[model samples]
Target: MKRWCALTKKKTVLLYLDRGGGAVGVCGGLFTATQKGQKAPETAEGAEARFTRWLQSEQLFSIILSSMSDLQEALAHRGSSPPSVISAARSGLSRLLDHLLDQSAGSFSGGASEWLKLGLSGRALDLKALVSALQQHFLLFSQRLHSAEVERRSLRLEVTNLRRGLQQGVPSDHFLSVCEELHQALSREQEAQTLIQDQSKQVRTLSHSTQELSQARKEVARKERSLRILGKHLSGVQKEKQQLEERLQRAEEGQRDLSRRHECVVNCLKSAETSCKQLCHACISRIGWLEQEVSAHRSHVTALRSELQDACLRDNQAFVPVEEFPEPFPPADPETPKPVPLS
Candidate 1:
């Protein structure tokens, strides 16, 4: 009997050979199954049985092939897949399929050395061709998987670099803006401080000026008081001077009046002296005249006495001649004659 099996892109064949021994040893071969063969099975029952077994094997083989393809595809697209683990799985699946096929053919060949000659029909299955095909497929699939993984890793790295660049670029502008704002704030604060200092200076100057003004006012008040006292003293002195002037005028008038009275008294004393001199001269002239009158009267009285004596002598001589003649008669009686002599 001859049978055929199909897997993904591969086809396998089995041949049953009857060896003459009572021990029925089995041998099988595999091919692409596209060509006609002389050993194609003749009995319908045997053909049907072989065809059914080939179908079952093809189904299982297809399942294993599909699972390998899926795993390779996943490895190609997913950067996180482990390459060593995928390689190990692929190797294990290939060896298992080879073992099952060899056992079904009742081959006891040991080691990979017998793998070169497949002993059924005294011909080999083309191991070099099979190894070449498997190697080509494995190399292509592994390359595609590695390339996809590289692309995935490169895309992720590029995204990360772009995000970092954007973040770093944005922060620089923000930092510059913050620095500018801080500079402006510092300038404003300095201006405010300068204004405050100027105001303080002005206040100090005003205070000094006010104190000076107060001192000036006090000096003015003091000056006014001094002037008032001086004025009062001046008025008192003027009154005293006027009183002294009046007293001096009165003393001068009294002195003039006294001088005039003294001159009048001197004139009256001179007039009285002239009158006394005239009265003394008149009294001296009267005494001289009285002395002259007494001398003249004494001379007259002496002359009268002498003249009376001469008259008495002449009268006696004339009476003696008569007396001589009468003497002779009177001598006769002396006593009686004394009386006669008196007669």
Candidate 2:
């Protein structure tokens, strides 16, 4: 079956690795740079160029290109349509490259971070290369299977010839026993081949899982970066406003009393904290909003802390970056007198 186009709407790309009848593996994610709202919309060709440049994220880009070349040769040799396969490669290449950025941007923590050290081991073997190797391995197994079948057929023919020769002169027990041993040996060889194939399949499965783990680690890194940005803005907001800090402290004190009365709220804080991450808008201005809310109405202090926490997590959209300009300095006069050295 054909693996279709990788590019999708919402800045996402889906690249599937087909294993015979089914797609056993995939690697994909959103275009990280799509946050730019003011950029002009480009035509299809221009968009492809943009994706191509973005796909060159670190060293993985070159590795993917090499894999693509190797894959093209495999496809052509297998008698698949060259033009269609080539086009698929072209589209898929961009998708593969774009996903690399998402992988790197994600936060890898816990066991996922540990796996990165051993992930694919070195630069010599990329994901596509690994997939190609697996395909080749399957081909090798098929060849071995055919050889075993031929050998078994030859043994059966030999057994028939031996029985015919022995039938004319009463067959000796030793000759019959020897023929039984040949059949037994063929049976053992078939069993051994079966076992080897099973082990190889297990290895293939493990490799596919590692690829998935690597992609997931990258995704985690992306979210961590966002949370870090949120954290940074929260820190800036808290330090910038003294009034907000005092009000928040009072709210926290009240929350502590409320928590004692309704102990279940402590357990609910995990979900509340998750919601806190979502409220990363207008963080600095949130302080003024909280002050107004506290004045305008009497509400549960627990809810107040959640809002305050959200305010801390999001940065104000109005925060503009100040660009640094290099200051010009006049050059020294060529004939300036040198200072005397201390004796």
Candidate 3:
């Protein structure tokens, strides 16, 4: 088993040697030219690229050295190194170093005996392989470093642009404080907007109330006008009633005067009736006296008529006796006319 392990370790070292030999052949010409100061023909851009790559390679070498030391410390403290330590060490150097370290740790036995045997037999070979491996690693690190430098430059430009844009508007030192103040201002603005909305609602309510009050006042004014008209009508009616009362009073006074005149006319009619009765009695007595005088005159007229009739009859007898004695008497005067015979 120990023999098999030893063989495997040798094989791993041989493989690393082969790889290192190939890298030396490829980069040997360039390394020789730089040392002799016989710089290779290159453009300005190519020379600048080479210089940046060299600087990055130096930085990488330092990082690798730091990781190796950290790994050694971890091994001493814990008596065994964790996988992270091994990974850190492997990532820092080339794959060749990783293969060698992995084989030695995994396949070999521990202790002084194994160490002495490995050191005595392979020390010179290991030294030669290590030197070659370092050269190859340097070349690989340079290539990787060139690519890393280009990416870093691009990232640096982007970061510079971002920083400039931020500085144009606000200072980086107080950026957080400015943002906080802006947030507070926005909150206050929102509160003020809400208060304004509430005040608008109150104003609208007041306007509605004012309109209602105006309508009420109009209604009151209309009612006042109607009351004024009614009062005028009532006053006219009162005036008419007053005139009627005055006329009625005058009519009553006329009726009292007519009653007094009617009573005086009735008393005059009674006196006239009494005077007519007295006149009627006096006329009746005068008519009775006139009838008595008419009877006395008629008796006187009848006595006178008897006297005239006796005288006439006596005269007729005397004349008739004288006719019998007419031839015996003496004659008187011739001229005396004969007496008229009585009829």
Report lDDT per candidate. Answer: 0.57, 0.56, 0.57
Backbone clashes, candidate 1: 0
lDDT of 1: 0.57
The lowest-lDDT stretch of 10 consecutive residues in candidate 2 is 1-10
Candidates 1 and 3 compared: the better one by TM-score is 1
Q: Estimated TM-score per prediction?
A: 0.26, 0.22, 0.25
Clashing pairs in 1: none
Q: What would the per-residue lDDT of candidate 1 be over residues 47-150, giving only the tens digit for each residue?
A: 55866797679766765665466456655674645864575465546445444544543443341234433232333446684566456545545654675576
Model 2 C-alpha lDDT per residue in residues 6-100, reported as the tens digit of each score: 34442222554442333323332212222345334345566566556766665565667664774557575767677758655754564464344
Q: Superposing all C-alpha atoms, what RMSD in Å does each candidate have to the true structure?
A: 39.8, 62.4, 29.7
By TM-score rank, best first, the candidates go 1, 3, 2
Identify the candidate with maximal TM-score: 1
How much does candidate 2 score in TM-score? 0.22
Worst ten in a row by lDDT for model 3: 25-34
Model 3, CA-based lDDT: 0.57
